[model samples]
Target chain A: MDIQAYISSGILEAYLAGELNEQEMLEVDRVATEYNEVRIELDALRESLLKYAQVESKAPRQEVLDGALKSIQEIEKEKFFEVLDDEPEVRIQRVNIVPVWTIAATILLFLSLGFNYVFYSQFKNTKDQLAALQSDQTSLANRVSETNEQLQYAELRIAHFMSEDNIHIRMDGLDLAPESFANVFWNKKSNAVFISVDNLPEPPHGHQYQLWAIKPGVAPIDAGIFDHNQLVQELKIVRGNVEAFAVTLEKEGGSPIATVDKTFVKGFLKKS
Target chain B: MTPTIESKISHLLAERNKEAIELVFTHYGSLLLNIINRVLRDDEMSEDVLQSVLLKIWQNGHNFDSSKGSLFTWLVRVSKNAAIDKTRTKDYRLSQESKNGVEVVSIAESISTGDEIEKLYAKQLIAQLPGDQKVLINMSFFEGYSHKEICENLGIPLGTVKTRIRTAIKHLRSII
Candidate 1:
């Protein structure tokens, strides 16, 4: 978001007045931590409010301070309880209100307000439900990575792989490793390549399988290195154009150049 | 700016120093008294409430964590709670309810105005605020109302209430 827009959201002001609910307060805390200016602004608002409070401050009678100071030194109650001057003053005074009509009006107003509050809360609950649904709609797949949403993402990936914009390079194991196979989901437009291991034998702990993109006579591009235990791995960075993709066994870090002799599985685009 | 009183608060509490309580009372006594009076509006009661609040601060010294908030914020919150308790007392509430549903803020304001020191302090900062912003501050801070409550009472949308009050605070901050 625009920093200025976020700063102007008035969330900070609500935060200062303690008007924000728990969720909103957490948001304010997070925002204040991230933005230096927000913390500064929050501090300034607090200082200004404190000063205002001080302006309205009235000094208690001197006797009260004496009582307070006595309480401070001795927290033990029994000694002060019997002798000290602290007493619960019967300070309330009853005022006779002669206006019966206003009381009747107040009762009626309270009844109507009570009903209005119920309806307003119901409306608020419905709005909350709709907001929850909208959030689900936007990030439905992201919410569950280990369950139904993961299945959805898997389906989406498969559909994209099979789409017309994608080039599917099927790799079968070489003569030395004939049981292995893999597939590359190569999206040429975005230059993204995801590898799904079909039946490749796991390389030993100290070794790895590295994918390379070769343009025939040119030096092969290092697609990426993958952990032997991984079922699928997406190369971090991929550039446009490649004639063939190949996997080779290499030392753990992978080699700058392909280990040409160890091409366990290889595939080439049918130059169209 | 001088050092924040917050940095020294935890030390004072941890040491359980009597002199420290005196220092805190000298600096923040009026502020806490004002806050309680805003809620309770009785000098007689605010006196007792302020003592209890200060006693709580002394007793609960171990609970003060500076990371949670500044010392002033925490003190004001405790004062507000004590003031609430004062107002919630059966006698006080019954007496207050009988006052024709009108609050006694004017009486409290008059008392405040009589204190030249307090009046000057109040006017110095609060006078700098625009009329609208001053009212907003009064409702939000002194009356302890929420943003939504302010919106409902003022007949404006919540967004306008938030933005206007915030911008006012921003302008207030600049002058301070």
Candidate 2:
């Protein structure tokens, strides 16, 4: 056979697809056996066509298989009866006076049904297992995100405290109160103080803890009212080069001037 | 135990082994369905024909020679033939061309649910073929139209249809 011409004709594609007539099929198969290229090319076409078909394929319902099996049984029953009614020579030749093909088909049919059941069950179990794993993964991801958020918050706090531009101010008790103390975290650039009322005594009713920023020979500036009862502001904003810091008990709102008699705890920003 | 399932599966199937038959059905059931559905274009009829095709594959398992082609290719050839046979029926041809006046959607959309459709070796390979080339393949392989019939339907010469199909498949040899 002129293999190249036969291949170029594209009839082999049709042939491998079983589209060729009997004569053409024989010719193609004969050449395919004789020539390696023809066989390989023919096979490749088969692979391509099947791969294409496989992609577009969908399974009929399991009932389709079950129904098919039942139909096979019906077919076998008819075949058995027809054989019993005719072909006496065939019956005598074969053992049990029955067509062995029918029995073999019946056994294969039953085996196939059993195999189908096993596959379907296995498929369901695998699907269920996959679903469970997916849900487990989702919950683990959520938990990881929650932990990440907390770690981020702690990191932010650590960064804020360790910032190079911040000044820590520790206030000791004045002569009237020896044990009272408090601390302030002042960011010099921002002119803001984060105050901690560590050991200051609770103020009397109708009075509040007031914070002050003082300069040498200058009157105190009312920084902010730090009323434990009525204030939620933890950081007080103040400005200027302060020589001293002080806290005093003031009236419910605040005092325009310092009432030094009620001075409780104080601290000055240490010079760097 | 070959690195690829192809050889091991081919071995199983060539022996008329039950496992091979089951494996083939599990793997290529949708493929057979898709090929038939593409040809028949009717779900119910396609399924009936699909069952029949599967039976033919099973009954004639010994006749299948794997050295010539992989089991999948043989199964595909069987499926396409079965589908094309259904198309040749008068009732099927009439319902398809006359009753269903709408231009059919792509084969990809019809076999919508299967995992195989996701891979769409069919869509990628055939869709890449220029418009007429793809149509020519489908008309011949899926619709069971002969080269003459395809040429007549498309009003092209016989040699054009034949050569186009040949080249298109030859092109796929490289791509696949």
All candidates: TM-score of chain A:
0.44, 0.41
- Clashing residue pairs for model 1: none
Write the residue-wise lDDT of candidate 1 on A41-156 in tens digits. Answer: 66666667666555544345556667877886566556567444444232221122334567888999999999899989999999999999888876765655556776877787
lDDT of 2 by residue, A100-128 (tens): 78888899999999999999999999999
Residue pairs that clash (backbone atoms under 3 angstroms), model 2: A57-B30, A57-B31, A58-B30
Query: Per-residue lDDT of B69-100 in model 2, one digit per residue for the tens?
Result: 55656776787788788877887877777645
- Sequence-dependent TM-score of model 2: 0.39
Docking class of 2: incorrect
True contacts kept of 1: 0.52
Q: What clash count does candidate 1 reach?
A: 0
Off by over 4 Å in 1: A1-6, A21-35, A54-67, A74-272, B1-4, B18-50, B66-88, B104-128, B152-154
Local distance difference test, each candidate = 0.70, 0.67
- Model 1 CA lDDT for position A62: 57
Worst 10 residues of 2 chain A by lDDT: A227-236
